[model samples]
Target: MPMPDMNLLIALDALLEEGSVVGAARRMHLSPAAMSRTLTRIREALGDPVLVRAGRGLVPTPRALALQAQVRSLVEQANEVFQARDEVDMSLLERRFNVRSNDVFFGAFGGQLVDTLRVHAPLSTLRFAPEGEGDDDALREGRIDLHVTSRRNFGPEIKVQLLFYTRFVALAREDHPIFDAPITPESFVRYDHVSVSRRGRAHGPIDLALEALGLSRRVALTTPNFHSAIFSTASSNLIVSLPETVLWGMRELGLRMRPFVIPLDFEPVQVVQAWHPRCDKDPAHRWLRQTVKQICATVEERNAGVWPQP
Candidate 1:
């Protein structure tokens, strides 16, 4: 017996992906007839007609359709493996990275992230994505490069690491009457509040703490993200709740972030960096994670008063 032509795998993979001789030709910059000949070779190797004519277009046969995703992933991983890091001059690495985070994330830490990256990778760009109801599908599909979030029970396949710990604080503008007087639960409850929760959550540690003492704040405005609450509180009298480590320089920008004692103590929030395990050993991906952590450290230093810097 003789060894098979393994080089045909690439062509087979392309043909399976495109399902059309013309499409594979366009992708590989070959004429349709040449691509057809290449497909004939692929069929000889695979022992199957991968792309069978179906109606006006070609469709993959049973074996080819089953092999589609696996082949694509394998070829992609192989390509990356061969394209190892050479002299990576950050200034020359031009790319747009998408990040999935909520309003509080961008308002609090995004500035530091941008500043840090710009000082080194000046050619890079950022796309801040919107937070939705549940798992970030963008991360799975490679649409998002980084995910800044708190620790939550996602599936085991997802990888995560702790970045920092943050504590909650209530925010009110400078010269707000609450700051001038005693902040009892009753006093706090009397004021209307602006708040955020991804699930449209009606309550939190603050609400629980207040309930323990038989009191509650009137949450006049409810939004899906911390950023939404921040912008709303900037001009209104509504009190905003936030994690101090993330919300930077808000007071100087005319939003006073102040500390208030909830009736009961609650745990400090843990800031985490999460990504698909597929990026585990990637050098550039690791570099991005480290850079983000460094920026978090710098921002945490400024928020030391709110919580002990981690």
Candidate 2:
């Protein structure tokens, strides 16, 4: 038996990804004719028309669809094998990391994160992308290095690690009339409310908890992030419910906001950091992940004694 040409794997992976010979050629820096020849060889090796012409373009065959993820994984692993390093010297490392997270996280620990990275990887850059409301393919597509979120519906190939936990706490202006008395379900519902949801949702666990008690509070405002909701409380009678840890962050900003426990049983938010398995063995990526975990712990420790949390 003739030995199979392992180089065909790269062409096959590129063809399956682009769904067009020209696009694959451009990706591999080859001419269209050369890409076509490579594609023919790949078709013969795999015994499948990996991409078939359809409506002026090409679509993957069922076989190609099944092999897509596997092929990509193999290619990534092969590249890692060739590029593997024994150790990553942080002082000399120069790379940019893209992290996606909500504003609450940025407001609370963004400065510390940047400072820590500057000290460790002086030439490295940290870019923070805003969280999206819809299903995101950023991690799998390699658009972002890390996704810090409470969402757990990521594809099976994504690796996840718990960062920390937080629960909801209500915030109001320092001199709001609500501060005059002990907060209860009834008093908490007396004033209008502000909410933070990336999906523009006007209700959430807070509403369900209120409904359980036969009590309902009107959401007078809905902002797409916690920063807006937190700032809105500074000038209005509206109370905002946000992550408990964010209160300390607000205090550091010298915002005259008062924090009080919401009078309802609520689930703790299990914050997690997710990434693609492609970065699993990359030394620099591993160091970045460890740095994030360390930053979260520092934030958690600094927030202690500031609020009574469960």
Candidate 3:
């Protein structure tokens, strides 16, 4: 079967509403001859002379009268499909957002973020997933709504926004020997270290920084997550280096540990929130990003001293 001309629907709508070829032509900004041709096409397509001469003006045929309301409704609905959505009612929005991040982020601000969402978008749910091996396919596939991390090599197509900056600090048992004297590059390297790496690697930027100072620390233990590193450091002499911001909520856990400044000068870690471009204009996704930013700001304020050093 042949497809019908969609343009004829607009012309038919104008002709029925105006009830005159000249008036319809003016409404559609077309010549009277062109409008007459369009009306002839509409008649042939519908097998009905949709408009007929009634004295000095045109009157709709019974079939055209029956279709006027339906045609108007279809045109109105089509117009709405192309228009921008300008408002969102939060209370009425029900959605689930899956956020992927390291354990440190969840341990720090996950509770606060959930609480904020409960108060603002009561019907929405938040899910946290662990950051697996630096892959971004979850975001591109829409499985993960947001990704929070310090490493930002998610490729050019992914949209990234800086959430906050943090610096590495040494975490050790409260009465560890490192606290007995002033920490220097020489003294800091003397203690055995516990290193955290998601990929199970033993060395990182800390090793490189120490190498530049003609010093090196012994990474006696390797852990995949911050919590394990903290537990290991708290119970033994192993000193662990982690971002200061990650320790935001650790105090509530009653962990017997203290943080001290790392002696070597290293670049600050940039923590960012990334998402796929597919959800850039979605109102619900936009709200999720804004809420994540607000939560990061609140966490930063509560732990002001953890910011990147100059």
Q: Which residue pairs show collisions in model 2?
A: none
Model 3, which residues run further than 4 Å from truth?
1-84, 305-310
Regions of model 2 farther than 4 Å from truth: 1-4, 12-67, 133-141, 155-158, 251-255, 304-310
User: Which candidate, 1 or 2, would have the higher lDDT against the true structure?
Assistant: 2
In order, the Cα lDDT scores of the candidates are 0.73, 0.87, 0.85
lDDT of 3 by residue, 270-307 (tens): 88999987678778789989989988876556677543
| TM-score of predicted structure 2 | 0.80
Per-candidate TM-scores read: 0.74, 0.80, 0.71
Q: Where does the lowest 10-residue lDDT sum fall in candidate 3?
A: 301-310
| Model 2 lDDT per residue over 1-310, tens place | 9998878888888888788999999999999999999988888888998889899999999999888867887888889888898688988888999999988788777888899888989999999999876647788767789999888999998999999998888889989999898889999999999978878899999999999999999999988988878778898899999887677676567887778889999898999999998898788899889988988886566667566455
Model 3 TM-score on a 0 to 1 scale:
0.71
Which residue pairs clash in candidate 3?
none
* Cα shift from native, residue 296, model 3 (Å): 1.0
lDDT per residue, candidate 1, 104-164, as tens digits? 6777778777886788789988778866765555565455777888846656777888888
Q: What is the alpha-carbon lDDT for the whole of candidate 1?
A: 0.73
